[model samples]
Target: MAPMYDHPGEHAADDPIRLLAVRDTPLSLDEVHRAVGDAAAGGTALFVGTVRNHDGGADVAGLGYSAHPSAEAELRRVAEKVVANRPVRALAAVHRVGELGVGDVAVIVAVSCPHRAEAFDACRMLIDDLKHSVPIWKHQRFSDGTDEWVGAC
Candidate 1:
């Protein structure tokens, strides 16, 4: 699919994949928001994923995230896919690794587009694809003395 923008052949310098990272530090909403700021974009959409206290009826006692060496490259690929055939003006995504407590931001993604609907769609696609395809695994320690890994290949 062809890329969407106001000017054709002029977006090479204005790449849409603005920010992509896999960090051990805490994620920031302001950073993601600032990365996707575009002059031409009329709407910006954001999604924040947090570590919840419970999952699948199990009380999560602790959580940690580990990522493969290629996780950042894989994240870039996911972001590219979201901007490939869409009207996305800019996009940013960050996933946190290492130990985290409940209510901590695990992931943050944002997208800017010429319209609200496009921004929403692109942002949704960005986060969904990142979670499913990125080489990041979650280790969950439950209150019942059981532990499990999620999204490990």
Candidate 2:
């Protein structure tokens, strides 16, 4: 499919793939980055969220992610918003669902822009908005044999 936006000096179809998905499989940073690879872009920014071993002063043994049916669609909306607001060359993001262990990559996002500052700002906006607005929930398993869910569907 063609890129959703075409700016001056940049053909919409000339951009790389724009990925948006929520899946049970492992996510690859390289894959997301590659999707946003654009020769005309002077800067590419990436963000990776890993499963850490702790949350809320509790030791986390592992975690699982659950997504609402609209999670993927919401992700696409978020990406499109970033694209419309920024001079992005290309963008991609993937979020891993199902169970995850400590150090596992939970989410990966990449954005390419014509300038470094724009790339950084857009990348940050994409991730921050995604975390706050996406309908993805986190279930944390504590070392003390308890669990709780974070975020609403």
Candidate 3:
């Protein structure tokens, strides 16, 4: 199923998790924090993935991301796993596609929990799992004027 947005105030008082995806655009850390905020949450952890100026030992010029049509479904699955395995009060994952330059935000994940430990653990696991499981590929452009397609890195 496609990712759906919950109407404002529509979720149950106890409902405190969310997930999202978007095309190429900058990610706002404040927006992610707000999305994971809740009266019941005491801790929030966020992860931001950015296009680095270098990869491996090569100087990177830019990158382009492409994903399978089922990317959202895979993302949802990963979010569910996080919620099930940890004391997550709220969770979200967003990834950008298309072309990106150095320093562009590639992915953002936020998690809220009753405590700092769980929030930190769940947030890290979410990013690691997403990178491994999501069918998104990146094309890396090197300063040497060569391009190579790489799996999530």
Candidate 4:
């Protein structure tokens, strides 16, 4: 199927895929859903990672994220891998940094494909690979005035 948006000089019929990478102040599930929506797409899958109030029974006050400047480049590489491994009609990934309160979205991924199976597979692969390979790190702040640096936890 054709992509909903096409590049200049490229026919919509010729462009079968679309991809986006963003760094947002506050992430939204609706934004992710919109990025992957296309009439030609038969399936869409999304993953959202959020901050929880407690970890291992610890009172989590908040969390902070840090990333190398090359983090966006690395995320783009993962997105490219998803496109290479599946027939993705549209895909988007965004990760937020800085301080976040409990229940805030940390990351979001959306993928659309021609079939449900590939959509699920690609969505999972995108999140898994991103968590494993991305340079972003999180610092968990506990209510006890303690902090821990977690590597993709």
Worst 10 residues of 4 by lDDT: 1-10
Candidate 1 local lDDT, 1-153, one digit each (tens): 112222222345668877777888877788788878889999999999898999999999989999988888788788888989689998888888899999999998899999999999988888888888989999999999999999841
| lDDT tens digits by residue: candidate 4, 70-131 | 77777778888888889888887788888899999998887989999989999999999989
Q: Write the per-residue lDDT of candidate 2 for residues 56-135, one digit (tens) a residue.
A: 79999999999888887788788889988999988887888899999999998889999999999999999998998989
Model 2 scores what on Cα lDDT?
A: 0.82
**lDDT accuracy of residue 111 in candidate 2:** 93
lDDT (C-alpha) at residue 124 in model 4: 96
Residue 143 error for model 3, in Å? Answer: 0.9
Model 2 regions lying over 4 Å from their true place = 1-17
Candidate 2: minimum summed lDDT over ten consecutive residues — where? Answer: 1-10
Clashes of each: 0, 0, 0, 0
Ten residues in sequence with the least summed lDDT for candidate 3: 1-10
Candidate 1, poorest ten consecutive residues by summed lDDT:
1-10
Ranking by lDDT: 1, 2, 3, 4
Q: How much is the lDDT of residue 142 in candidate 4?
A: 98
Those runs of model 1 whose alpha carbons end farther than 4 Å from true positions after fitting are 1-12
Task: Give one digit per residue, the lDDT tens place, for model 3 in 29-148.
Answer: 776777788678788999999999998899999999998888887887888888899998888788888899999999989999999988999999999999999889999999999999
Q: Which stretches of candidate 4 lie over 4 Å from their true place?
A: 1-19, 22-24
Q: Estimate the lDDT of model 1.
A: 0.83
lDDT of 3: 0.82
Clashing pairs in 2: none
Top of the candidates by lDDT: 1
